[model samples]
Target: MHAAAATAFDATPIGSREAWGWRGRTLSRPVATASGEGWLRLVSAPADKACGKLWEGPQEAERLMPPAVPRPRLRKRLTWTEDEHGYLAELYDEVTAPTVTTHEPILREAPDLNDAWWEGLSTALDAIATVSSDRVAVRQEYLDRAMPQYLGIPIDTTVPAWTTAHGDLHWANLTSPSLSVLDWEGWGVAPAGYDAALLYSYSLLVPDTAAEIRRQLGHILDTPAGRFAELVVITELLQTTTRGDNLGLERALRARLAYLTEG
Candidate 1:
């Protein structure tokens, strides 16, 4: 998103201070959203397939997403300005409550999730799965091509199914208390288990939480396609770690891969 990963919470990207903060504290992370107001995102160009997906992601999500899902509505698409890396910075409005807690390092233990929260999240995902759009993207080829290089090993490139997904389904993008799936910039068609796998990978630091996600999404993740999608997600996080993201998750991710391959 930013010129470098270091620019996440601190950079106050040019032209985006109003959305993020003019005077914020120290931080790291490319995306930033004010609690009750708006958010700014780091993007590249329409030509860059990955950045292009990020740019169109929220708009498409706004159009196709079900009513119950919690997401920041796109109030407007601000003009893109060139960033330090020749990427672009865009801003939009936040829809959900400011009090909601995104599951980063905040949650010391699992929150007691009621049936409604689970149902809403699951139903929202189901609605996304039914959508059909090539404009809203994240193709299967990206995973297939990146896997060998990312994992430092070969893989079975057979993709059995594809569906709409919140491509970056991680702790930071998710909120507890009400189960809101934030950050639609990565929403698009992907291998079936991609979303579940991403959340699973992110939850690896907590065994009980990770087990709960697996149990809840077992129907989707138990299939061959889901397992492969989980592999793709693991490879991605592992790659991110290589660049200094989740340093603690590498060992857990490798263990997961071994378990998956064995199963």
Candidate 2:
């Protein structure tokens, strides 16, 4: 199965042509761009569905950033009516660091991430986690619903503390040499340790990588609350494994689950 690239947009929105050039394709509908002076992104969604700020949730959450953390700064947003979905567009200052998600599908080769980069990512996550918000990360909800269908296993309904999370925290969404997590559309209040769990889940294919994530974020993943969040992440990964998404990590995820649940 061929993965679709965001670069193959059926049409570029009206305002985009005048302001920015396509920087690159992301894994989804939103395309990043170079706006001569700064960077921006083009987000599109169905028209009937009420189009507002492109990547509305992410943009709103970006507003909560503290002085230290690095994130794309949104300058302007424009929406235009279209035949199918409306064009939801936003322009932001470009990120200075290189993205870790350069490879088409999943990252085939790991980038040269160092201690500073990982430390920066951890610090940014810590900052985001301290924030308070009413926004809900809908993608996590959908994934929660799908977990039962995928795992066919009973879930511990014990609720955990919630806080602001980046929603999507894969390597592709993060930069190297410097730390700058990208794609905030999914950021919102989530279960404790949610971000760490998701990152660890994605890293299960690489034992050393997975271990490093656990080592750095162990404070979050070691708590009972963190363990529950990890279970949620495990369920999601197991689903992807069944679909043949991350084949290399299939055995590792199952083994991790066994270790996690054997208690």
Candidate 3:
């Protein structure tokens, strides 16, 4: 993949520094492009699973998202085949600011997020929700089944409102000092307040940060749609805990579920 990225982008990958996604499905490295410095990301999938929303999300986001949203800009894309595997290489404008975390979605420590950063996030989220997309990030069927099975809430599973969302808004996908959101491969339609709810859920490990998020997004998080979105996120994380993912957040998540249900 490194060789392919270098050849396709006509750039030299630097050093041993590399970023990898879950199960090594994606790899990102800094490169020296002819225009300037850039980040190269490579995604791989079985040939059968290579054509779908996930495969085309970045390009779609590049086309649809406005400049007001602070995100990495996709520069170019290339695709290739090797055996049963399909590989995609995407080069993006370099973002110098580091991610809020080295890895992991849960925030263990508080980041010095300023008012501007918080305001930018709120504004960007508002902008994102207004866009229309057929891609479904959190399906109603999954919410219907997961909420009852995980949250023990047998109430109507229909989402109160549906809106376009970043779909996977977490600490690792965010940057500080300048506030650039990353990883647009999953942006799509979801329950209203889904992004805020997801960010609030991940911030739970740090109470102050979580409280700040709640405060910044109170207009959304405090509404019925927002509450339902929170429950949906909680349900998903609880289900993942059974798979040994995010075990540290299990207790906090359950407590949150109890609070939400009790309220």
In order of appearance, the predictions have TM-scores of: 0.73, 0.77, 0.98
The residue-by-residue lDDT of candidate 2 on 61-117, one tens digit each, is 667877556777766655566577555555556566766765322344445678877
Model 3: ten consecutive residues of lowest lDDT: 1-10
Report lDDT (CA) for all predictions: 0.63, 0.64, 0.92
Candidate 2 local Cα displacement, residue 65, angstroms: 2.1
* Each model's Cα RMSD: 6.9, 6.4, 0.9
Question: Which residue pairs of candidate 1 clash?
Answer: 8-29, 8-30, 9-28, 9-29
Candidate 3 structure quality by residue, lDDT tens digits, 75-157: 99998888999888999999999999877999999999899999999999999999888988999889877888998767788
The worst-scoring run of ten residues by lDDT in candidate 1 lies at: 21-30
Order the candidates by lDDT, highest first — what do you get?
3, 2, 1
Candidate 3's C-alpha runs over 4 A off are: none
What's the CA error at residue 206 for candidate 2, in Å? 1.5
Q: Which order, best to worst by TM-score? A: 3, 2, 1
Instruction: Tell me the RMSD of model 3 versus the true structure.
Output: 0.9
Alpha-carbon runs more than 4 Å astray in model 1: 1-51, 80-108
- Model 1, 1-263: lDDT tens per residue? 44442243333333433223112311212244443344555544434343466656777787878776666665544333334323444445543433233324222356566667667677777777877777534565777787888776777776778887877776656665666676676677788877877877777777887788778888878888888888888777788787877778888889988887775
Q: lDDT, candidate 2, residue 102?
A: 52
- Sequence-dependent TM-score of model 2: 0.77
